[model samples]
Target: MSDIRPGGPVFAPEEVETPPKEVSKSSKPASLWTDAWRDLRRRPIFIASCCIIAVLVVMAIWPSLFSSIDPFNARTCELATARQLPSAGHPFGRDNLGCDLYARTIYGAANSLVIGISTSVFAAIIGGLLGLIAGFFGGATDTVASRITEIFFAIPSILGALLIGSTFRGSGLGIWLVVISLTLLGWPMTFRIMRAAVITAKSQDFVIAARALGAGSARIMFRHLLPNALAPVIVVATINLGGFIAAEAALSYLGVGVQPPEISWGLMIADAQRRFLEAPLPLIFPAVFLSVTVLAFIMLGDAVRDALDPKLR
Candidate 1:
C-alpha cells in the first residue's frame, strides 16, 4: 500500500466495475392465424371469393336489411315497368310476375345457401363417422359397411335422392332424404381413404409405442391415429361441399328437391328455360351464382389441401 503509484491501480484499477449490456428478446414470430391471413390477403381470387361469399351470407341472413320490397308480394306491379331491363331502380330487372328480380334473386340465394350448407354438413357428419368406424374396426364390420357403401354408390346420387325424397312426402323430409341419400353414397370415398390411412398409421412407431404403453384399442385409434389421418378427410369434405350444392340444385331442377315457394337456383334455371328468349336474366343470374359458388369452394379446398400437406409445404 505504501508503494502504490497514482497512475497504477492496486488490482488493475478495480476492473472498472461495469454492468453487463442488456439484450432485447427477439420478437416472437407471428401466429398461425396471422400468417394465414397474410397469405390470404395476397391471393386476389381468394379475396374476391371471400367477398362474394360474405355478400351472399349477409343477404341470406338479413333479407330485409337491403330492401323493403316484400319478396312474396307479387301483386305490387308498375304496369309501365313490366319486363324492363336493368335500370336504376330494378338492378336485375323484373320477372314473369312483374316482381323485382333482384329481390327474388337475393332471397333465392339465401334459400339455396341454407339448403346446400345444411345438406353438406349433415352428409359429411354421417359419412365421416361411418368411414372412421369402418376403417378403424376391420373384419365383418368393415365388410358389411363397405358392401352397403358400394350398393349406394352404384346407384346414382340424384336418382337415389329423388326416390327417397318422393318416399318422404314433405319439404323438411325431402331435405333430410337428400342428405341421407348423399351421405349413404358419399361414405365410400371417405371409407376407402380412412381405411388406407388407418392401415398406414397402425404401423407407425407412435402407434406401436402407444400399444406398448398399454393404451386401449379405442384410445390408440381415436386419440393417436385419427387426428393424424384427418388432413385428407378435411380436404375431401371441403371439396364435397360444392358437390352437395350442385346435387341439391340438380334435384331441385328435377322437381324432387326444394318445393314450390322455396326458390332454388336449379328451379330458377328450370323456370327460366321456358322463357330463355323473353327474359334471360333469371337463368343467367342463378347460373352465375351457382358457378361462382362452386368455383370458390373448389379453390378454397385446393388452398387448404396445399396448406395442410407437409410435402407441399
Candidate 2:
C-alpha cells in the first residue's frame, strides 16, 4: 500500500467510505412555515375560509377584470337590461337602473373590505398604544384610562357610529366618519387587554432584571413587555376584524354608513330591501357576500388562534 503524503489531501482513518448519517424514519425535520401550513391544511374550515377570503379580496381589487361594465356607471335606457333574470349575458341579472348587478356586487365587496381593513388598522394603533400605557403604568394612569374606556364602552358601537356618520353626511366625510367613530369605541377593549398583560409582565423576572440593569421605564415597557404581550393582542385583533366588517354593514343599512354615489355591501342591501318581492337577486347577492366575508374572517381568526396556541405547539 502507498503511504499518503503529509498535508496532501489525506483522509483521516475514520473518514474513508464513512457511512451516511442515519435519518430516523419516525422523526422529521422541523420548519416553522411548513408546520403551520400543515396544521392549517388539516382544518377544512380554515382552508374554506382562506379560499373565500382570497376570492373576495381578488374581486375587491380587480372588479374590471371580472366584468365589462363600470360598477359606478348608470347604464342608459338603451341597454334595456334592468331586472333581467340571471342568464348567459347577465349571470347575476341587472339592477333597478339596468346596471350589471354582478359588477356592482364586486365593487361593493371591495368597498366593504376597504372600510373594514381601514377601520381595523386605525383601531389597532390607537387602542394598542392606550392599552400599553394603561397596562404598563398602574396607579392614577391606569384608573384614568380605565374610566375613559368604560365610558366609551357604555355607548353602543352602532349608535355611536350612526351619530358620527349622520352628522358628517354630504360633507365628503363618508368613510372617515365611520372609521373615527369605530376607532373611538374600539380602543377600550384593547386597553383592558393590554393593562392585564402589562400587570402580569411587570412582575416577571426578565422585566425586573431589565429594570435593575438601568433600563428606562419606556424601554422596559416597550422593548421587553410589549413584544411578549403582543400575542394576545394579535389574536384579539384578528377576531375583531369580522366585527368591524359587520359593524360597517349595519351602519350602512341604517343610512349612516357609506353614502350614495359610493357603493357598500350594506348600502346595496338597503337598496335591495324595497324591491325584495319584485327582484330578490339584488338583496340575495350582497347578503351572501357579506355573510361570506364575515364568516371567512371568523374562521381565519380561529385558525390563527389555534396556530398560535403554545399548548398546541
Best by TM-score: 2
Candidate 2 TM-score to native: 0.84
Model 1, position 178: C-alpha lDDT score: 61
User: Residue 63 in model 2: shift from native, Å?
Assistant: 1.4
> Candidate 2 lDDT, tens digit per residue, 250-302?
99899888777888889988888888899899889989989889889988888
Clash totals for all candidate models:
0, 1
- Residue clash pairs of candidate 1: none
Q: Residue-wise lDDT of candidate 1 within 1-313, one digit each (tens)? A: 4347887655544467699988768866775445645665676766776787788789889988877776677565464665678888878887666767777777777667776677556655666667777776778888998888788779987777778777775647645666666666665676666667776777899988998999998898789888877767777777777788788788878877767676767777777777789889867887888888888777776777665664664
Model 1 Cα shift for residue 12 (angstroms): 25
TM-score (all chains, Cα) for each model: 0.81, 0.84
Model 2: colliding residue pairs: 135-195
**Per-residue error (Å), model 1, residue 183:** 3.1
RMSD in angstroms, all models?
A: 6.0, 7.9
**Once superposed on the true structure, which residue ranges of model 2 sit more than 4 Å away at CA?**
1-42, 76-80, 311-313
Per-model CA lDDT versus the true structure: 0.73, 0.81
